[model samples]
Target: MSDTRNAPHVDMLRSPLGRVRGLGSAHRGAVTWWGHMLTSISLVPLTLWFIWSMVGLVGASREEVALWLTRPVPLALMLLLLVATFYHMKHGLETVVEDYVHAAAPKFALLLAIKGISILLGLLCIISVLRLGL
Candidate 1:
């Protein structure tokens, strides 16, 4: 009984109420993406610096290696590398799990685990670095 040409448009998959209630997409696409990119970009230089520092310490004795870490430059850069790499890894996994894992429960669980483990590992590294400096 309705005129097809004059009918209002409606999204079949998502209801109008859903849109009004803001129950879609989570609006975090750009933030998560940019965080990943920035961390990745930062990691390039940090990783290179770490490798360069390692090369210098390659033939050093245990005490020499410990002395290197006790220095402020190596200590700070190492902590930066730890934090940035962990954050980068966490976000990368989050994007992958979010895209591929469709189930809500599993997706949430995986993200939580990834972030939690990443934080724990990063903290452990930082603590170890600080202990060496102290």
Candidate 2:
């Protein structure tokens, strides 16, 4: 039997330095929450404007449509919507890919491909909108 006074004691819950190292501050999750909120709020007005504009054009004549689209303000808004939509989509798809794709190489490749496709599609949409405006 060992003497109790000379025995080493281990506290399972506490370390000698007082706490575990490398465990960072707790607010990291809030960043993602805020990012989602910001993206959502931005999309709301853009989506409403796009839908309203389309509804207003439902029965417009070809020339009238052309004239409306060619205006600088609408054209600018369309461009902004195109960019914001693609950015939002990229963020969402990236999250999905990160969550579901377990393999490193395939995950990275898929993410890169998604980004490429989103950029290309956004550019194409901008060009098409511009051509219509022109």
Candidate 3:
């Protein structure tokens, strides 16, 4: 055991040049993080609107519900809700897969599936809403 307690931190072992050269965020992390944050923030109001609208339509007949959906504002908001929900879900699952799934092959497959399925579901929802509205 050394005395005087003057040991330098491990990070101090690297030169400034070495520190600068080391692997950083690769710049994509912030973009993904910000996207996740924005989607989540947008979801709050969108989700509330969806729930409230659905509550109002609870006792409505199929034709009545369809009639309500035909409105432009409701249709647009529904499309936005689907897009933001799927986008948010994709990013959340991707972060989980990246953090925990160390195997490269599985991680790649999961990420690809996440993106594909998110897009597919979002598009399907948009199409359904369009069919009802238009």
Candidate 1 accuracy as lDDT:
0.83
Candidate 1 vs candidate 3, lDDT winner: 3
List clash counts for every candidate, in order. 0, 0, 0
lDDT-best of 1 and 2: 1
Please give the lDDT score for candidate 3: 0.83
What tens digits encode model 3's per-residue C-alpha lDDT throughout 29-115?
345667888988999999999999999998899899789989989988888888889889998888789889999999899999999
Model 1 vs. true fold: TM: 0.73
lDDT of 2 by residue, 1-134 (tens): 76788678765533433343522243133455457677788889989999999999998998887798799989888888888888888878988998899999999899999999999999999998899897
Q: Which 10 consecutive positions of candidate 3 have the poorest summed lDDT? A: 22-31
Q: Pick the candidate with the highest lDDT.
A: 3
Error of 3 at 121 (Å): 0.7
Question: What TM value does model 2 have?
Answer: 0.66
Worst 10 residues of 2 by lDDT: 22-31
Candidate 1 lDDT over residue span 1-134, tens digit each: 66788778765544566556645465433456668888989999999998899899888997897799989888888888998898898888887898899999999899899989999988998898888877
